[model samples]
Target: MSYHAIVIGSSAGGLHALKTIITGLDASFNIPVMIVQHMSPQSDNFMSRYLNQLSHLQIKEADEKEPIRQKHVYIAPPNFHLLIEEDKTLSLTVDEKVNYARPSIDVLFESAAYAYGKNLIGIVLTGANSDGSAGLKKIQEAGGLAIIQQPQTAEVSIMPQSAFDACPQAIVLSLEEIASFLNRLNNDTQSVAQPTST
Candidate 1:
């Protein structure tokens, strides 16, 4: 099945995990990816900038009202919660923190599940806390795909383990395996999008 978007949530040992997965994406990968990486409220755009330098996709801090576009990676800004609107546009809020994070993984994943439903893919990467488990479960309930980093391979296993506990059906993969799975999905989607020659 063709997926429209991907929502990723992470904390703690997230940077390395994000880099591994994003770098594995093919240059032709054409899907919007939204990420909520737990950070200090004073954090800057350095993470996005750093990832952009190493990725084929354009990675940036998401802007208010920005339309979600393919081949671009949008990261939630510090001290703000990023949400996906039903119209497929982005909105940002300084709402009270959930899971003690302004850019809570639950906020993004729930809104994305509502907006994209079965067309969404939600991923929970390595983290120290159980922040994303509920959100990933919501994604699964909405018929979206749910994936979690294998607890054994996670630098901090609490988050992935919590997610797996919440949604036992979610696929659990190592960092490398997760990357390969995304690449395969990208390839499949790309093949479907290409025009068939007579």
Candidate 2:
């Protein structure tokens, strides 16, 4: 299938996991990626800048009412919940925290599922809490693909394990395998989008 977007959620060891995945995508990768990595409300834009420097794709904090564009990575800013509007633009809200996180992974994933339906891919990475499980399940219910980092390979296994339990059909892979699989998806999508000569 030609996935249009990816929504990723993480907590504890999220920075390292995000870095690994973003670095794996080559410059030609076209899928839009949205990420929610739990951070303190006092955090700044440093993480987005750091990840952008490490990735070929442009990485930036998701802005209010900004359109979601392909080949870019958007991260939820601190102290707000990043949501996908029905029109596919972004909406940021200072809604009360869910699962003890302001930028809740569940919030992002659920909204993306509603917006993209089967064209979405939801991935749950290393985390300490169970915040992403229900969201991943929602993605699966919407016929979207679900991927979870292998609990054994995670820095902290609870989050991935919880996702696996919630969505047994999720593809469980190690960090390296996840990267390779995403690259393969990019290649497959490229092949599908190319016009075939008669």
Candidate 3:
């Protein structure tokens, strides 16, 4: 039940959903979380601040070369690509857009798979576009887990629908169900860290 990292992707109608899911996670969660929510450089800085206010966790726009932490949530700053480094550090790239987004979900997911291997968990949230679909598929291909919001329950169904089509086996659940699932993962991961015998 333990993983090295978690990567999430989202677009339109994502703000509230993102807040809900991240806020549901407790401060004791020790699995590195990285997010690539489609945004513009001129976008409001409220995402980090808002989630921070709502959750017990620390939320921030990630800095280049910063160490990725399990108990913290890292949001890709508007207009940058977030990648997970093998050394467990955050990497930001200014490369051309993928799927028409500077902070493409595909970029983050692919890089996360490369960095975390079987220890990656990718979640795709509400959005109007199909940005996170490719990334979610990659996570599945890399022996990791993929979760998508139930399209019917999403504010914007296209994103979740796209991910569902890409990875049919992905866990499709409601926002509350998604919250429950993540919490279980968080607790299971923490339990493993305790001193135990083989």
Candidate 4:
């Protein structure tokens, strides 16, 4: 099946995990990725800039009411909750935090599930808390793909472990495997989008 977008969530060790995955996606990858990485409210845009330099896809801090474009990665800015609207645009809010974080993974995943449904891929990476567990479950319920980093491979296992527990059908893979899988998905999508010679 073809996917339209990817929503990723992470907390502890997120920089390394995000870097690895972002680097794995080559220039041909067309899926738009939205990420909610737990960060201090006082954080700046350094993470997005750093990842942008390492990735072929455009990675930037998500802006309010911005349209979601393919081949781009939008990261929720500090102190705002990033949400996917049904119109395929992004919405940012300073609403109260969930799971003790402002840019809650659950918030992003749940909204993306509503917007993209079965065409969405929800991923939970290394984290210290179970913030994404409920959201990942919601994605699964909406018939979207749910992928979790294998707990053993995570620097901290609580988040992935919790997600696995919440989603028994989720595919568990190491970081390397996850990257390979995403690349394979990109290949499949590209093949499908190409015009077949008569």
Candidate 5:
């Protein structure tokens, strides 16, 4: 669908799945990815190191006011909410938790909605709570695409189930399927932009 950005949300059993997807993506993938993975404050820098090791793409624990860039994967810092700004940069805060998740998926999805609108692609993966449902819906409301991992295949089904119950149009598929879909989408976008030889 030619998305300019991808926003992903996950919790339980997400580390392996996320790594699998990111590692499968091409190194030059032009889409910027932002993620909100529910984590304890004690786990600070944990996901960063894990994902960095799993994928060649630049992966890091997001910092306050960090600028977003293509081909980079930005993970919300533990216990902080990550937001997208109008100018295409990232913002972080520790105001409060939504659905008991300080790095709430709703905050990232909603802010991404405002920042990228119709150009955004949202994905909800494994989790034990309903934190990402509202945010995924927000993305769709803003004319962005929404994807959810198949509940049956999810390590923890509550998150995807919530998304399913909330939005019937979401594309629910396995993690590998999602990656293949994104890879095609990225290539399709690039193809349309490249001028044919004269």
Candidate 6:
């Protein structure tokens, strides 16, 4: 399948997991990556700046109504929930938190599932809470690919474990393996024609 977009969620030990994944993606990686990594409301843009410096893809805090584009990593800003509109653009909301997070991972994944349907990839990485499980299931129900970091390898296993519990068919991989898999998907999309609508 020629996936159009990727949605990732993490918490607690997310910085390292995110960096490992982004570092493995070279400039040739073409899909837009939307991420929600739980952070304190007092947090600044330091995470974006750090990741941008380390990744080949541009990383920035997603802006309201911004058009989602390839070769960029858009991160949910602190104190807001980032969502994908039906038009494939981005919209940020300050609505009540889900899973105790303003930038809730479930919110992003659910919206992306609606926007991209089967052309979406939802990944649940290292995290401490059960926030991403329901959204990963939503992605699966929408026929999108679901990937979870192997619970054994996760710094905090609860999140990945919860996702696996919700969607047993999700591909479970280690951090390094996840990056390799994503790269392979990128290469496949580059060589193959976009899949025709069924």
Q: Score candidate 2 by lDDT.
A: 0.94
> How do the residues 8-58 of candidate 3 rate in per-residue lDDT, one tens digit apiece?
888888898888888777667677789888887788678999888888878
TM-score of model 1 vs. true structure: 0.97
- For each of the candidates, the C-alpha root-mean-square deviation to the true structure, in angstroms, is 0.9, 0.9, 1.6, 0.9, 1.1, 2.9
Candidate 3: residue pairs that collide? none
Estimate, for each residue in 1-198, the C-alpha lDDT of model 1 and write its tens digit.
Answer: 778999999999999999999898888888899999999999999999999999989999999999999999999999999999999999999999999998999999999999999988999999988888999999999999999999999989999999999999999999899878988887787777785787
RMSD of 6: 2.9
Clashing pairs in 4: none
Instruction: State the lDDT at 127 in candidate 2.
Output: 92
**Per-residue lDDT of model 5, residues 31-138, tens digit only:** 889998888877868888888987878999888778888788999988889999989989989888898998999999999999999999999999999998999999
* lDDT (Cα, tens digit) per residue for candidate 2, span 1-198: 988899999999999999998998878899999999999999999999999998889899999999999889999999999999879999999989999998999999999999999989999999999998999999999999999999999999999999999999899998888888998898888789886787
Candidate 1 displacement at residue 109 in angstroms: 0.2
For each candidate in the order shown, give its overall lDDT on alpha carbons. 0.94, 0.94, 0.87, 0.94, 0.90, 0.95
Candidate 4 weakest lDDT stretch, 10 residues: 187-196
Query: Candidate 5: lDDT of 171?
Result: 96
Task: Give the Å error, residue 139, model 1.
Answer: 0.7
Q: Which parts of model 2 are misplaced by more than 4 Å?
A: none
Lowest summed lDDT window (length 10), candidate 1 = 187-196
Q: Evaluate model 2: give its TM-score.
A: 0.98
lDDT, model 5, position 34:
95
Q: Write the per-residue lDDT of candidate 6 for residues 151-171, one digit (tens) a residue.
A: 999999999999999999999
Which stretches of model 4 miss by more than 4 angstroms?
Answer: none
User: What would the TM-scores of all predictions be?
Assistant: 0.97, 0.98, 0.95, 0.98, 0.96, 0.96
Give the CA lDDT, 0 to 100, for residue 118 in model 5: 93
Where does the lowest 10-residue lDDT sum fall in candidate 6?
189-198
